[model samples]
Each structure stands twice: as C-alpha cells, then as structure tokens.
Target: MKQFNQFAARPSAMSRALRKAFVYMTLAGTPALLSTAAYAQAVANDESTSATGVGAGDAALPTVTVNAAGESGQHLQTQSANGALGSRSVLDTPFSITSVTADDLADKQILKLGDVFSNDASVSDNSGGYSAWASYITIRGLPADWQNSFRIDGKPFLGYGITLPYDHFERIDLLKGSSGFMYGFGTPGGLVNYISKKPTDTPVRSVSVGYTSGNIWSEHVDLGGRFGNDQMFGYRLNATHDQGETFNEGYLRRNSVSLALDARLTRDLTWDFQSIWQNSNSDDQTPSIYTANYTGATLPSVISGGNRTLVGPGQHLNTNFQLYQTGLTYRINPDWKANLSYSHSSARRNRNEQTIYLKNAAGDYDNYRSDYLEAHTYDQWQAMVEGNARTGFLEHQLVFGASWQKQVNDYTVNSIYQLSGTGNIYAQNTNAYYSNTALRTYHAGEITQQALFASDTLKFSERWSVLAGLRYNQFEQNAFGIGGNRTSTYSKNATTPTVALMFKPEPNTTVYTSYVESLEQGGTPSLGQDNYGQQLKPLTSKQYEVGAKTSQQGWSATAALFRIERAAEYTLGNALVQDGQSIYQGLELGGAYRPAPQWQLGASLMLLDATYKKGSTFTGNRVAGAPKNMATAQIAYLVPQVAGLKLMADAKYTGNTMLRAANDIELSSYTLFNLGASYTTRLGKYDTTFRAAVNNLLDKRYWQYQYENYIKPGDPRTFSVSAKLDF
Candidate 1:
C-alpha cells in the first residue's frame, strides 16, 4: 500500500469505533441541522410582524436591542473588552488594539495563531515555520509568554502551550503594550484574546473541506442554534480533523472538538459554559538549529528553501489539551452589573527530539537526543462589579474586580545521550547511532497569583475623557526537586498602574496619550548554564505612548509613537546575570480604507530602535531578535460584474535583525508576496464558497532570528484550496 494509505489505515479498532460513533452522531443530527437552515431563512423573510404588530401602520415599532459579540463587516473595529469596560468603542480605548474577524480568517485560510499574524507588522513569532507544537510571539519588541498571554472571552486561558485551532474561534483581539494593570503578572509585549462563537439566534450550520500542500487534508463542521419555547437556551458546537504530511518531511495529525452553551436562567441573569478538547501529534519533527556552540568555526551557509537538516525518523512529539469554563452575568439594575467566572485547563506532552551540534567549519556535527514527558494544569477564577452613573455634568464608568490563578507543572527528562557520528549539514545522513545512559529525575513546580484591580473612566465633557486603573498582585512559586524534595520557594508583591487622557476635536477623531507599567516573573537558568536552576528577581517595565485614531466614511486610520524601557537579563561568560537595561522606541502607522464600494486596502508600517542601554560588555548594542523595521500592505477587489468574486494580494517586509547581544551575527531581511481568490455562489438551494491561495509567491529564502544564535528558516512557496457548504 502507498504511504498515505498505510497512514490512513493505522488507527486501532477502538479509534475506528470512536470515529464511527462521531459520524453516526452527526448523521443522526441531520434533522436538527436542516431545521436550523429553515429557521434562519424564515427569520430573514418574516416581515409580517413589522406591519401587523400592536404598533401597526402609523405607530412606531419597538426598539430592538442588538449585541455586538464579534466583528461584523470588515475587520476594522471590535468591542472585546466590553464586559469589563461596559462596551466602550475601540477607538475610545487608550491602547493599540486590533481585531481579526471570522471573515478575515476564512479569506486568508488561517489555521494557527502564527498564520493570523503573518500580515501584522507589530507581531512576530520565534518558532518561525519549523515548529508546529506551540507558538511564541512578540509585540512591540517584547516577548509574550506562551502560557500567560492568551485569553478566551477576556478571561485567561491556560491551554496556550498547545495548538489553538482557528476553526472554533469567532474572532481574535490583540491588545498591544503592557497589560499588567488588566491581567496582573504577564509579559509586557501584549495579549491575545479569542472570542468563542456564541449560540446563534438566527441559526447556523456549515461544513468545509480543504487541502493544502504536502498532502494535508482537513474537514470541519460548525453548528449553532437557539431552542426552547422562548428560545432562551442556545448551543454552538464545532469539530475538526486534519491529517497528512506538512510542507517538510514530517507527518501531522490533529483532532479537536468544542461546545458552548448559553442559558437565560432569569429575566436579569444569564449563564454560559464552554468546553474544548484537542489532540495533536507530529512525526519526524524539525528541530531548531543553534550556532552558539561553534566557538571558532565558521557558520554554516543558509540552507536552500524547502530543505532542512535531516534527523532520525523516530523523533516525534505529541500534545493533548482540555479546557472547561463557566461564567454568569447578573444585572443589578439598568446601569449596574456583576460577573463571575471560573476556568480550568490541563495539557500533556511527550517529546523525543534530536539536535545537531556543529563541531567544525565543515558542517561536522554531533547528534544529541533527548526525551521528555510533561504535564501542566491551571485553574483561574474572577469576579467583577461594574456600574455606570452620572453626576451633574460628569459621567463615570467604574469597575472593580479580583482574580486568582494557580498553575502546576510536572515533568521528567527520560533520557539524554550523545550519538556517535559526525554529519555534514550540506549532505543528507540520518544513520547516526546513539545509546542512552542515565535516567533523569522528575521535577515539579507550582505558581499561584492573586490580584485586585479597579478602573474608572470619567467623561468630563462631550469631547474629553480620562481613564485610570491600578492593580495589586501577590505571586508565589514553589519548586520540587528529585524524589519530591522541596527545593525552593519564592514570593513577591507588585503594584502597577495605567493612566490615559483623550481629546476629541471632532466626532470621528480621537487623540490620546497613555502611560502603563507591567510586571513579569523572573527567569531560571537552563540545565547547562552556571548557576543552573537558580531563579532571579522579577522584572518591571514602563511604557509611554501617544496616538491618534480617526474614522470617516468607510476609512479608518491610526498612528502611534511609543517608548518602552525595561530591565534585561542575559548570560555573562558562564553565569546568568540581570544587570542590564534595554529600551525600544518606535513609530507605528496603520490604515484601512474602502475607496470604492468594491475595493478595500489595508496597510501598516513599524519602525523601531531597540538597544541595550546598560550592559556589562554589550552596552549600546542592538537587542536580539528585534528587527529595525517592518511593513505590510494588502489590497482586495471585488468584481461588480461577477458577484461574490474577490481577488487579494499582499506583501510583507522585515528588516535585518540581530541574533546576539554582541550584534556580530545578523539575519538578512527579506520580502514576500501572497495571492488569493474566493468566490461564493448557490448550487440549487445550498450555499457554497470556494477559496484558493498561494503563499510565498516568489519562493523567497529567509531566516528568522532568535536569541543565542538560533535561527529558523521561513517556509517555502505553498498552495491551498478549500470549499464550504451551508445547509
């Protein structure tokens, strides 16, 4: 049998049975799915009530209350923090924020968080295109922690260290800058919030099948509806499966399921629940290449596009994640509300990896093998009370909240060994032999955090507003060494604040200035470093920003100038040190415009100057992994003659970036282009949509810079096509 066929048939009997059960369930639910479409059509065509109701003919119709839960038209605006801020406009917020809507995800064929930020000038990922396990992103020259910077519906999500499928999200919101006052202890870079698809009041049912380069195939189903006598109960479910080889010489398999429920228990109280499960595995995974070990040897030449250093075929990685969340909202009065929520998440991973360490200038290297089993669990709870009031000529929106989070991690390095073989990067050889010697001990740790926060937004006049917020946090961490012996305990307390002022000369324009601070946990030394396993003190950062936003007709524009300063840490000789400071100052410009009814344009530019202000030996050098400049622009046009037909083109550029604190090694800049086309039509009564896209149009070869001389290569040219059907 062919390799693909063999892979498809490799599942055990139990796995096959489970798959069959899922298929049977979907088939049995066909009636409900069909009814959903019928109900939606009926609601769209029902206008009799508008003409024959109690307020008929000459009388006015009752006011309708509409909730903006997700992005609608174009991806220009959002209300992601509405629950906490009382549904304020994005333009009115004193921070840089952007929303990627469902339409954008569909049009771009986004599958992961990295894909969502491919066109964002302010965002970059460290893993590049080599790793499919988890993504690490940076914003505004600061790194965001993979486990702490992700949120679901404005609440922290602990399942971020695993694959986050895009199929289950309605929209994603990005808040740039320090979020300490909002989310307590976290990275200063930014925060990413995923809004789940709510139960649809109008009913929804859709299925899509797709194929991408490297024989990857995917299938997804989404269903949502409102039921019950008064339609007070609603549900939304999503399922997806993907399998096959990736762009590289590796195999991937993934499955995910998500369900959400909404219930209106009383006239003034509502409850929501959500659950998600996901499993993913990759074989022959690509490993990150590090060049720091090549002390006196010349660096290897850049590998050609679409190629990578070969490793043992047995290397693999697997991850499983599960999450559950529940929340309740109670309206005390017309202007007062209370909210409470809780979430729990668990994740596990098994990895067997091999790294090639260069030994000479001729590409000779040693193969190092490592195996690990790890698990993580997180629990979080939050409660808040908010109200809107007016006194004399001043209007105020106030919020008071408290949150607590706990995280536990356990891991064991099963084995670490050196293989006896010398390999060349320019040649293919994977027959290296290795023997495992000693077994590593298991380690465990726990982190707990409690925080109290409050914010007030005062509208002093029709064209002026001021917002201020503060957060006080207490954090504690405990570590256990081999044999469950208590190793170390650390605790700290911090206070952070945010303040902003806004002025509007016109109804459609806003100018703002803001100051914010963030607090991050300390770093621990790696296994091979001197003082290994030692923890340093936490770090704090401050940011100052001034910006303006404006919207007129179908066009929107924003500009910002910002500066951030923070304490830094790095290895000096053999010991890790924190006696360094860094600063990043930059200007950002972005805009979206629909000049004509059928044409749309989006563009962004970022210019940064990142340097070490004070360091032992690398003072005044460029900060590692920070590019000097980045820009992206896209245009989409719809053919008026052929309805539902749209064509898009986009280009991205990244300037050179330093790979080390010394600024001796740098990754050259590169530019890439992408093209896409999508069409929507009706086949009889079934609505259908077709999409096709080509990434890296010119097959440009480039490298993504990382700290410590580690480099990741960009993906080569790839093609994808998908079709969706709506019942």
Candidate 2:
C-alpha cells in the first residue's frame, strides 16, 4: 500500500488572487473590529468615587503589589531534567520528556533544529533539512551526538558542525532515553537542552519581520529590562538577520547575537551571564546523495519542483560561532541549594562540496569534489549541592553533582576530486561544471571527554517515588597522519547508571519505571579498513522503560515503552569486530489538548523496532535510519469572537524506512501538510502580530533521508510571512 501522487500544481493566478484577498480581508474585517470594540467598551467608565467621603479615610489606599515573574503561556511544559533528577514535575518525571516552548517556538515558525523537532514523534531528521553544514538528529534509534548530545543551560555546547541559534531560546528540552546517568559519554539517542533567555523582571521590547518562499529575508530584535534601584540589574538582548534565496538553488546568510545578564547578589544570591555570536553563509552547497554503489538500480525519477543545480556555482559554506556563559545561585536556607556553572563554546567551518554518485539506472552521475576545514571546542564546569528534607513520612530530594567536560575537534580534509562528470538525472547542467579548485590538507582529528556525577530523589509516601543516578567517564582520542604524525591515541574509562520508579495515583496521574546506561566514542579504522587507523573500543548502551504521565483540566499526556541495547561493530573478516547485538523497541505517544477556550491540540506517536538482534550477517535486519511508523498532529484555533485571531493545522507521518544494514533498501512513506494564520491587534500603543503560512500542503514529492545509497528530498511547496512588534 504505497501510493502517492499529487502535485497538480495550482497557486498562481497571482497566487490565487493573493489568497483570495487575504482571506476576504481577514474574514471581513474581523467582525467589524469585534463590533466596534464592543461598542467602545460598552460606554467606558474609568471609575472614580471616594474623593473624601464617609470616614474621609484616604490612607487605606497605600498598598500596591505587583509580582509576576517569567515563563507563562504554557503550551504544555512542566519542569525538566529528569535523568539527573534535578528540576522535576511532569508529574514527577520518570522518563521521556519533551518541552519545546517559547510559545512553541513562535507558534512553529521555528527555523531549524528541524523546526522544533518536527513536533516530536521521537524525532528523526538526519540532516535532510536546514543543513548548510550539519544538524543531524535521531533519537530512539540512535544517532544524536552533536558533541555529546547538546545542551546549553545545563552546560556543554558547540555541538559539532554547528547551526544553533533558535533566537535565544527559552525552552526546548527533549530528553528521551539513556542520558548516561545524565550525560557522560552520549548517544544512546536522546538529550538536547537549550534553555537560556532570562533576565526579566518586567519590561521587554520586541520587533520582527520575515518572509520566506525562496527569497528569504528576515530581521529580529528583542531587548529586556530592569536596571539598578531595588531592581539590582538585569538585561537581555537578541538580534538576528537572515538573507535570501534557498528553496533549493542555494544561497543563505545569517548573523546573530545574544546577551543576557542578571545580578541580585544579596538576598539569597544570584548571578548569571551569557553571550553568543554567530555567522553563516552558504551558496550552492546541497548535495548528499551517495548510493553506496548503485546495485539493483532503477529508482531515480522524482525531481519536479524547481531549483535543480547539482552543485557547481563554486559551492561554498562557512560558519563561525561562539558562546560563553556563567551562573551562580545560592540559597542555602529554606531547604538548601547551591549551584555553579560555566560554559564555553566555539565552532568554525569552511567547506566546498559536490557529492552525488549513482552511476546506473540511467541517472548517470559521478562528481565527488570535497574540501573542509573545521574546528570545534567546548568546555564546561558545573557544581551542585541541593537538598530538601522532611522526615515524617520520609521525603528527600537531594542532588550532588560534579561535572567537567572538554571537547576539541579539529578536522581537516581536503581535495578528493573526481569531477569531470557524466550527469543527467533529468536535465542537469550546472553551468557546465563551474570551476575553481585548490585545496590541500589531507587528514587530521581529535576528541576528548571527562565526567563525574550523582543524584537522588526519594519520597516514600503520598504516592511513592525514587530516582537514582551515577556517572564517571574519561575518554580521549586523536588521529593525525598524512605526515602530521600522531597516528592514533585512544583512552577510556567508564561507569554509568540510572534508575527510576514513581507512582502517584491521582494528583494528575503518573506511573513509571526506568533503567538506563549509555556510553560511546570509539572509531578509527578508515581508508579501506584492515586496521587502517585502528583504535576502537568504547561503546556501551542499554535502556528499558515504561511510562505514563498525565495532567488534567488543560490536558497533557505522555506514554512510553522502550528497550534499547547495543554493541554492534562489524567487519569480522578484516577484524574490526564487536560481534553483534543491536536492538531498539518502542512505543511512545505524546500529547497536549485544551479543548475549549479557543481549542488547541497536539499529538505525537512513534512505533519503531530497529533490529539486528545479534549478527554476524545482519541477523533480523532492519535498522538504518530506523523508522516504523511515526506521526504528529497539531491544531490551534482561538478566534472565539476574533480577539487576536489564530488558526493552524499540522500533520506529518513517516513509515517504511530502511536502507542498508541489509534490509535491502526501502524508504517510502510520507505525508506532510501545514497551514496557518495569525493576527493580534493594537498598532498605536504598540503590540501587533501577523503571520501566515502554507507549507507542503498537497504538493508532495517525498523522500526525507535514507543514507547508504542516499536520498534526501522533501520540502517543496512553500510560502511564508510574518510580523511582530511590541513596545
């Protein structure tokens, strides 16, 4: 049952008369501006009465109180960091987390990180979108490892081939399975933090502008408040810029800056600071289709939708980034607390590429050309001491943490050349192979890690609880040859663990179970293997889970069932062995619902099997980008009488995936749809919003990633718009 065909092409006639005059002037002037502003606020009154009356007492009006802090507008979020047993709730976490907020990343206009994790169906998008270099993702079926699974407020940043900037984030959690006792050596597939954006005791000003179809264009700014006085300082700022051409024939540019600062220093102590900078550029750099040696060919046809250019406009990509952070929080009073943090990050890149390989089934191709120079650095330090106590029925929430991380990756690869193409996958003519080639570095590398951790959470009654964790790791690696000496070095040490159990029968339900472990960082042997660079040994993984969570009234939900296992290394004949075992089992579901008060709903689902149970020869197969059902859904409304209009729709589905691991090629199954609208009011006193969208919406031409004989495509129909202001 694999059938798809729909691209009847329509939208032009001046784009259907400008989308029917912008939806009939926004549904006919939004109920006449909500009935003339509800009849001028029903005969305005502005009450005033006691100027000196009974008792002539005017001294009783001297109490003014205003207290409001941050993050509200909850689109489902309830604390985070469950693996380290820190931050809690989500019905007292046991596992499986997903937060995403900042108003759900500006109502899903998210620009990357796979657009807010594609609404989480256990995430999967191994760089098939927004890649001007790298982004790769995959969870619940491995992959992930952008420098040890990324994080920001919880430290560790500069995730490998970078591309981070989610407009100064303020939420984005996602922690699904095995976080090596809360991050040690990673990749059992899960973890992503990013929470910054603080410093707000009040005031903030905003601005935004955007456009997208292929002409891109964007601008953004945000600033925040409080300074001196009894306020004791605070600040926040975010800036951005984006530029042009990219719905295929490639071209992009970006810039960013962020800053945050805060200080209180006396009552309970506090201090925080942050900084960021980014830069990017790209031009003609798309290519990533390998076809590991064509074989049973015949699968090339599907390239409708413009912007073809198979790489040659001289291809280029560039990136630069930086970050610095600091933190300190001390309470040490009602239940104790002490924390410390530090972070440093860096990234750099320069590349030129043109891959493509498929030399059969008539789509004749071949063009290799490669070049790259990269650098990454990350450093982290953390200290924690937390406590809570109660002994009547046994209650304790304790944490003891210690962390130190260091990462350095300096890579260089230059000139691979195989150009002199034979292209033709349906009319290809990249300006007759635009030229310019001169590069020279040949190979180099480096890697490192260090860790130590601990945690606890217990509570004996009021619906039981328990959590435990541990970590200890040390790893190092290096490889540099091509004359620069040092052909390899590897070091290792390990320990990881986690445990959880919880039950609450009703204050908004919860039931859970967990066990975890993970560790990774091993690899060498390349250049036709046979102990080419050797150095391997460091991989361990395991997970087991069961979960449930719920929230009532405004709805929230979560579910899980998991199993993971690993240790699969290959090459028995040339001897790079680990002698098999890989498994993944799953079922996950996610939720949110509002039902009324202007409806809202969200959903997620994933199935997954990911086998290769124990193999010498692909035993049970299946596992290559692992996919076995995935789903997502979303809906939003609000317009109950038009005040601040809203509307939205979303969908995504994926299934049937497998491309190698001897599963005999697969990849087919797709679905996508999107639609949106937004509006808010006020223009004179400031506060305005406007947005529009229409993505993919029935213009299907699938394929969203399948490596090992490549495939990437996905993303066609597009259109976008935006506006925002608040003073």
> How many angstroms is residue 441 displaced in model 2 relative to the true structure, after the best TM-score fit?
5.1
Q: Encode model 2's per-residue lDDT on 1-727: one tens digit a residue.
A: 0110121133235434434544544443344234455632332221113423533243122221111011212233366654356776656778787777776576567656766777788887656434542566678766676666777776776564467767678888878777777767767778788887877888889877666777666667789998887999899999877766767756676788889998998889888898888888766755666666666634576664435556555666778888888888899898887888888888886666667776666677776655656677787777877778877877888877777766765655443344656576566646333333554444465566766677777778888878877778777877777677887687877878788888889767878888978887654342333674455767898899998887777677778899989876544444455657778999998877775667777788999888877677888887777788789887777655445666777887877677656665677778778777666664434556667777767878865663334565665777776666677
**How many Å off is the CA of 556 in candidate 2?**
5.2
RMSD of 1: 7.7
Tens-place lDDT per residue, model 1, 25-95, is: 43433322233445433433453355466434433222222111111232434555743344566788777
List where candidate 1 sits over 4 angstroms from the true fold.
Answer: 1-4, 9-76, 82-87, 129-134, 158-161, 295-299, 358-362, 413-421, 431-443, 524-535, 574-576, 706-708
- How do all models score by TM-score? 0.88, 0.32
In model 2, the clashing pairs are 291-709
Instruction: Report how far residue 296 has shifted in candidate 1, in Å.
Output: 6.8
